[model samples]
Target chain A: MSDLLTIENLKTYFFKKKKVIPAVDGVDLKIKKGETIALVGESGCGKSLTSLSIMRLVPKPGGEIVEGKVNLDGVDLTKLTENEMCKVRGRDVSMIFQEPMTSLNPVLTIGEQLIEVIINHQKVSRPKAREKSIELLKIVGFSRAEEIMKDFPHRLSGGMRQRVMIAIALSCNPKLLIADEPTTALDVTIQAQILELMKGLTKEFDTSILLITHDLGVVSELAERVVVMYGGQVVEEAPIDSILNNPYHPYTDGLIQSVPSLTGEIKELHTIKGNVPSPDQFPKGCRFAPRCHKAFDRCFNEHPDLKAISDSCSVRCFLYEDKQEEEEYNV
Target chain B: MSKVLEKEILEKESAGEPKQEILRVTDLKKYFPIKSGVLQKTVGHIKAVDGISFSINKGETLGIVGESGCGKSTAGRTIIRLEEPTEGKILFKGKDISHMKEKELRKQVRREIQMIFQDPYASLNPRKTLGSTIVEPLNEYNLYGNQKQRLERVGELLETVGLDSSYSNRYPHEFSGGQRQRIGIARTLALDPEVIIADEAVSALDVSIQAQVINLMQRLQEEFELTYMFISHDLSVVRHISDKVAVMYLGKIMEIADKNSLYEEPMHPYTQALLSAVPVPKKHGATQRERITLKGDIPNPANPPKGCVFCTRCPAAMDICREVQPILKTKKENHSVACHLFE
Candidate 1:
């Protein structure tokens, strides 16, 4: 079966002043229908930019899709014109932003926001759209949907606003839902509710999700496949279990260990030594080599491409070069 | 640990009776009055920190974890007198400081308690050098007179926080988030504070950097003999650094206990739900866990429910919870819960 969304060689470049900084350099991603694929990375590692590039919503005047193909169901989204892209945006691909406060219009009523999306994407009357909007709110688990629809963004709490955003995102029942840190701004309990709602709703609609976040915990809970991104490059890609249990890439290993757990007590957390370098100051050889504990002379001088380590696991690191040797020994 | 021992010493001194209470807050309330129209009369109030009471041992780190608008930050601020309490008695070293004069408080206890804000980008003045930011507290407290002594103190503080004194001249913007946070820690330590309130200090940093900051905080707490009221929404971060943890709901503490006890065997239903919700990475396929998805949003503090604040969405809420508010009662040794079910 073909993927719901297939991104190939996608590069998003930021032209700050005059220098062209490649934020998402030579990236590849695939998301099957009803599957949740997580794009995990530290801040400014181009994870968010990759989602933006997929949606063709990169901030203007500075960023542009320098090169890449964003194919949604064999239809190349990159080839579409601005006007044509508008039709595909809410109908084919919808995006739920990180900050619900800013993403939602404070002046407009929740009903108006939901109705606008429904009417724009689908040929529905204003009355029908309003009714559908309430239904969407109810579906998203908002109690007294009619009452909530009358309320403005300021009247609702952060969680409620996020629910409204999800309702709007799912109103058109798009094939793909791109949630960029959907629960980042929410509390744990509220975040759990939202994640559960997203998971349940998407399954019901059989919708594919591109979950982008810095939280590894969310990735484990939501994603079937995990993509570890660093310095705008895919360092590791594997099934969620393989990536979590035995991460092949040093960066992925460091990230998983860094996550504080509740069940097992860790005496010391594995912390990556340095900050994620900006796109402009990206290291020459390996982006993670500066902080990687396993890095040696070869790691600093040569960049390793994503190599298949197992049937379901792939890693970009020199440490996993002799995969067969380790496999044979284990066998 | 040497740090834990240091805290014991500080606790002993602060408690005075060998069982000293470093900080005690009773019926703390901070309501931001919302006024409308030209009259601007005291119409309604946004009960940011409605009413809370907790005590911190002289040397222990007390973690305050709550969602936004849960009043954790406000509780910390009000306890420190950064924001004046509406109605409460903040007993520091067994003395009431809730309504103390600013001048007298500044001289007596202000320097003893310091705060580390959440946002490093906004907490430190961009215009001021890191040296000035660190030294400004010293100047305010009149800790030293000579410029040389002050510079020496600043340098010591920088070293204490694992930052180089050479970067003192550099602006805050020059440093990364983690480095800036270290600077914030250094600044908070300038007054030789006995108690420190870190308000979401590591929340804004990267995951890798968060561990570094948490370790630094743990180390500094011991070195300075500091008692901490660590406020954050992130449970994992709180669990990492805190000896004791308090779960806060809308303007009220839901549960409080030792870190291990609280995480291992949570008594409160809310705490259990919260713990279960946190995702843990597995080796293979996702393992199913009972996730209690709480219904509805947090109720507005201005018009909080008459009963238990958590009763609105609490799965284990009982009939009595709606008619009567539950008073925090001791459930176990050093553990307290405010749920009616426990009662």
Candidate 2:
């Protein structure tokens, strides 16, 4: 499969008068066509910045994508002009924010918002746009798409508003959807409904998804592959199952055990010691070494590059750095 | 009022129910008035906590789980008299304290019942040091020793909540999310509250830190013999923390059962959908994880479905479920469900 979205050595930094905060430091990720990739970490780990950088929507004045290239379907989004990027935003790549109720314009009706996006992207008449909006809402599993379109955002329930958001995002038929904690604000039951709806609709449209969330359980449910980010960098990247059951990076392993699950027999949860360091205070060597249980002498003094363990999996840890040790551990 | 914990009381019939039921809520209701026009006349009310009844046995955690606007938080607040109930009775240790005057509540119910809020940073006093924050509560109750002794007690409380006694000197901003949460727990523990109402206490922390706090909470519960009303929307967390779980919707409980029975054999359709909705860490079947994803959002609490609060979204919702409201009735030995399907 061709790469739908490719991010190379992406470095986004927040500039202050005296110091520069490298929120997303030397990150790399790739999402293939029709694949779902989950980027996960604790707060301040820079997962959000990576998504913002891809969309060329990083907040201005302080934050900027200092170094890196983001290519979506052979087109470098980083090289696109401001005006041209506007055209591509909804037509080629769309984003669904964490909170739908707030993200949706409170002043506008659901139909008006949906119609505006559809007409702006597609060469459709006003009536045609309205019809397309209704169709999009139906695809998102809305029972009364017609009624929902006439209603204002506040009139609908949280789940309904989220579905409407998805409907608007899908109106343009974008190849890739960037969903940042789409269901975080909804209930578990509603979350499941939304997740299932997104999965089915995206599959129908053959659109790849870049899912950014904190919940390990949600990541396990939706994403085909996983990229474990820490200190604004990708620590490990692998297929979802491989990352879940046998993560090589100590951070990923600790993270998996950290999430209390239903299946595990373990009594006490294994805690990763210490909080994620702020961008400015990140450790000198391996950023995770300060809190890593398996940190060795070299781990404290030097950083390890992301190394491939298998054809599709990789880890950034010195424990997997030595060729002989890597083979032994792999065996 | 409450047919609550009768089974648990009977099970411990020989040992004579260790630690007589600390808190019992019988048919509690808390409604926020919605006024309209310049007159500010009563238009309608958002039935935030519509008639709900449950009890917490001494030395046990009773988790109330639900989605947002489901009244889980409202239930917790109402129980502690933070948001006074519009109707129903609150019996803490078999005494009706539901309608107690604010002054009387402060004197009697206040010290015994303490709350741990969701946002640790917001809950803590930014202007106050960790020592003073915890000590402030102690000072209010005229707790243990004098000036020097209070400082010593503050240090002890800090240690009990798994923070270094030295952290008492640090400000709230200096501590991480987990540490701040620890400080909040320390404040909750400082009063020697027999029952702690933790409202989404660990929901804000990262998974690893959340685990640490949970473990700390479980440890503290055993040490202090604390009865917890753990409120959260996270199913997995509640499953791990609670001894008996009450699933609430639109301010009314859908089901209540012992942890094992509820997780293993969920009887209510709402419960069934809820359990299946929780995504497993590893794919057990991988391909065939049958999820009962409910349709639509939770109905408006102000104008809830006439029959059942959950009737609007229930998959197996019948005509009766749309007409006659079903009250919670016993199903199995220790399980109860409020659903027409159960009937």
Q: Pick the candidate with the highest lDDT.
A: 2
Q: Interface-residue RMSD per candidate?
A: 1.5, 1.7
Worst 10 residues of 2 chain A by lDDT: A259-268
**Model 2, A1-331: lDDT tens per residue?**
8999889999999999989999999998898989999999999999988999988899998998888899998899999999999998988999999998799999999999999998888898999999989888888887788998899999888888888889888888899999999988888888898888878965788899999999888898889999999999899999998888788899999988877765334567789987889899988889999999999899899988987877888888888767636665878
Per-residue lDDT for B140-208 in model 2, tens only? 878787878999999998888777898888899998899999999888888888999999999988898
lDDT of each: 0.87, 0.88
- Model 2 CA lDDT for position B15: 66
Residue pair clashes in candidate 2? none
Compare the candidates by DockQ and give the number of the best one: 1
TM-scores, chain B, all models = 0.92, 0.94
